[model samples]
Target: MGAAESTGTEREPLLGPSQAEATVQPVTNSGRVYGRRWLVLTLFSMLAFLQGMVWNTWGPIQNSAKQAFGFSSTDIAILVIWGPVGFIPWLLFMWLMDKKGLRASLLLTVFFMVLGSALRSVPLTNLQLRRWLIHGGQLLNGLAGPTLMSAGPLLSTTWFAPDQRATATAVASLVGYLGAACSFLIGPLAVPAPNDTQIVNSNIHWDTEQIRNRIQFVLYAELGMIAVLFAVVLLYFPSRPPVPPSVAAASQRLSYRSSICRLLSNMRFLMIALAYSVPTGVLAGWSGVLDMILTPVRVSQVDAGWIGFWSIVGGCVFGVAMARFADYIRGMLKLIAVLMLAGASLAATWFTLTCLTRLTHLPSTKATLYTSCILLGIFINSSIPIFFELFIETVYPVPEGITCGVVTFLSNLFTGLLLFFLTFYITAKDRDGKKQDNAALTRGLAKQM
Candidate 1:
């Protein structure tokens, strides 16, 4: 969270480089394997996906949600903000995942997710109560966000071979992005934009009653999926493998205090954390407000949602391919990360130009916009596995759970803080600006009379 402040001399005893290896138990590669590792990966990925889906329920359906719950742009932003708000208590979750191991954290994750999803599905008629329940549900769901994402590396370490670790992490970690992608499609398709011209008010397009009914339908359907996953986790999920899968998996890790001390002192980890967190944070934050950002460019909700869907879907496909590449080539994590960063920067620049073209005579086509989204998504998102691997390798013998959790927790915190202001500066301010423009026009007409 801060620049490296401790000197090497001061850091050495607090589980620095010299002492860090001492914490790890001697490890051996074993021939024994479990047939159930794949199932465990599937469950981890699925829970993460569901958590991501819950986080994004509003972004793709902002208009309908506003109508259904009497929400302002600010209110919608708050719900998205909660996606990262779950990280404020990052240490607690990290300790649970790291010290308590996978099953304890997973148990808590299911509990929070069930309560969160179920709260939203309640058929409450009171608008205020409905809003409260949704927000509360988001908060509880948010609490699970850190564990959902960070568990991938831990799960892989516990259940996968040395050769398969990075790939396993990639498959589990990136599936959450897939969950986000699915939500972009599901939210809009399930709660389709009304074709009717009927207006509920100055801003709302669909009837609140109709929108509410559809929203409940979506919530109930998603809740059914949640119930299924909850049952799966409760019935048979394991804390970890009975035997270590690889040498790295068997290492003892430093205590949290020592790990934090070493991490804060290590300049390389600091750089990696920054490189890993900031861009991803911005990407996640923007997804929540994409509808509002695209409105001025004449993009519809369905189009925006699909763009989001492709962005994430393309990224996941590209990520899986690149993870295999990284695994095959070895030691190219830094190169891969840098190249993707450069490409992503260019794609983002082009994407920004396409969006701004709406203000110019040469407005870009939808094809240009969609292409930019795909390119940006693939370039920026494809490197996630590399970064996760880099983080793990950079700080070996440090527990993978906390290592991933710390970086991801920082990313989520950055996102929540970013969206909080984005709501004020972009979404809410834009709405106020429109009202002011309308008032100014009305006054000018009155003066003319």
Candidate 2:
């Protein structure tokens, strides 16, 4: 078969001759099987898992850095921007994925990840240097994030049959979340007990700088593993299976602009984007602020780290199960919307309770807060695989690279903007309270005068 073309406005049948034959032939009589494809899927899942594992470790460790550097809430907030900043390079690389192919892109991403992680271990003399190195590391990792996030769906679509695509994608995506969980879980264990309160209070002190060095060393090792996988992908990853001429020819092709225009013009994309963007934005903000928010509630740093770890665990389990259920019921869009709405509601409840708890000076409602957060994690993450599948199905048979790039770009862009705005809003609220307090003080002095 010639190179597969990009998808277009009109829907075309995805069933190649093999699929059609399978429908007609007895299941036992079918000559073709995809045993090798399963192997590829497993490899891709591991790559995704490794990528996520590395990326999420920073969240649990952020408080330690904050204490080390004496960073305020605002400074910490600025740190979160590194992810979106890193995304710029990530998106640029993704645009090239179609022309470059999966193996090349995956290797480049892993290289960046390794480089970033290694650089993060370098000791800096001052806060400025520390900020630069840390954020710069994050920037590189962000570039890798999109590649890792999209790799699974693309692999599943290319390798798996239509009937099995959703399940395959779910499993791969679930692995990524599990990797994130593992990162948080591992980070606390990796660090040593510190002498001063900085590490103890923040729950992030690398007992010795050696811990950071060890992480970098492990990242370098993982880079070698990625290189091995890249070779495997090149040798084994199927571009497209052999197919009949007619079916191959009929696969609709369109220019990139045309495909994008169709996607943009679709009302469904807008609705899904809006619904999906909210929880995504919330999660980004929550991940950044979770430690800070817990401070007032007097939750220990270790507990906070565990909370983050468990949140990812809940998200991974719930997201996978829900994605599978959506496939089973054939209600992918509905399931995504419902899950997102539920997440938003849970988040709203959590935020409201948090504010009340703060104002009332009540005992830290850690259990309630953590429970809500766990549910929030699950529901928020549930939308991702669903959204990914919907984008592919809705824009039937597009070159997986282009389709994934466009969808991820939109989701990341909006989510980034929302996070920025939300940060601004929260900052403004704090400033307003300070202003009110000052005004009351001035009024009292004026009355005495």
Candidate 3:
């Protein structure tokens, strides 16, 4: 059967296959098209948000977790590796998206996400067992990364009209960043600044009990939120519309093997992937080691988390706005990406300089850092949907699942590798004022606090 027949949508030949050629596009008998697509976008965006939260869960609270478990920075570093670790499953999930469609893929994704959180929240007297369970849980949750990350392009292409595709993709993708933003806010609030009320022979001491309780609270809270979202997804989210949303979607999809091969050979696609990969990977690496990197300057987890929150807010707002603007002015996709990326680079550079030097002690440092973070967030996030839409447009006829999935996989792989190695370079001053390994670095951080 042709694409139209398979999707239960009628089509008529138009300018080209690249252009949606449907004369009577998918609509209800009442002539209203995609009455539920917006709802669908909301559901998928929520999933994307949860995925981001789970991925960055350890970052904001790394110090508390370290003090609680006596964990090394390397152990915490591995948390970021979960994304790369899922690459094998990522390939399988993409195949599922192609062969079985979004419904089956979403089911598999949600299952692991919930299971992972539950396992992580599991209480065990044996610290080693508890640690391993947390690792196992993160691993399971990692499997959902590609699915949520790719949902923007997959759902946008499958549900929206050509005119609205980029904006939808942007909104969905931006929510994931919003999740990360919330993680930063939630992290510090969950584990508030250590109380410095105690004075023992001219020494200020921390309130450790409060930190432990906060960590426990954050874990249970995360599990509760995941449970609620999981129930909603199981009951309401559809795999796809009964009728195809666009002529491009009504057409048969390319084989997974062929899609991969085509992507591998496409220099433009690789370039686009590379352009996105570098800044995003650096950002990921920075977020993972944020506490460690800022340790010397005495930046608290709450401060780090708040910075992240502001950045994400900037990213989400600009990301959606930029995507809508790109849709309005259709042909300048490459130009938009370039300008935004440059802005991100500048912001990251400025933020780095401010933190590295004692410039943060200067009166204007906080304002500078916040502004730079917001700009960095805006530039990096705003460019993502542009890249997603460009990738699909450049590689016409290939499924959005494959196009977006490959890019997500590559970016994640790069991020994981970058973060893994970046952990090595992070050093801290011990109680005796000597530079030491990450394990000692945690102790150093504790002493400083």
Q: Clash totals for all models, in order?
A: 0, 1, 0
lDDT digits (tens) for residues 29-97 of candidate 2: 112334556776787788777766655655555555544555555665655555555566544665556
Best candidate per lDDT, number? 1
Per-residue lDDT over 225-325 for candidate 1, one digit per residue giving the tens place of the 0 to 100 score = 88899898989898876655544455577998888777888899989999888888888888777876776777878888999999999999999898877
- Distance from true location, Cα of 346 in model 2, Å: 3.4
- Candidate 2 matches the true fold with a TM-score of 0.75
Candidate 3 lDDT, 82-158, residue by residue in tens: 86677666778889988888878888888898899899887776778988988888888889888888868888777
lDDT of 2: 0.61
The global Cα lDDT (0 to 1) of model 3 is: 0.75
Model 1 worst lDDT window (10 residues): 1-10
Each prediction's whole-model lDDT (CA): 0.80, 0.61, 0.75
Better of 1 and 3 by TM-score: 1
Model 3 is weakest, by summed lDDT over 10 consecutive residues, at 1-10
Q: Which ten residues in a row have the lowest lDDT in candidate 2?
A: 1-10
Ranking by TM-score: 1, 3, 2
As for lDDT, the candidate ahead, 1 or 2, is 1
Candidate 1 contains a number of clashing pairs equal to: 0
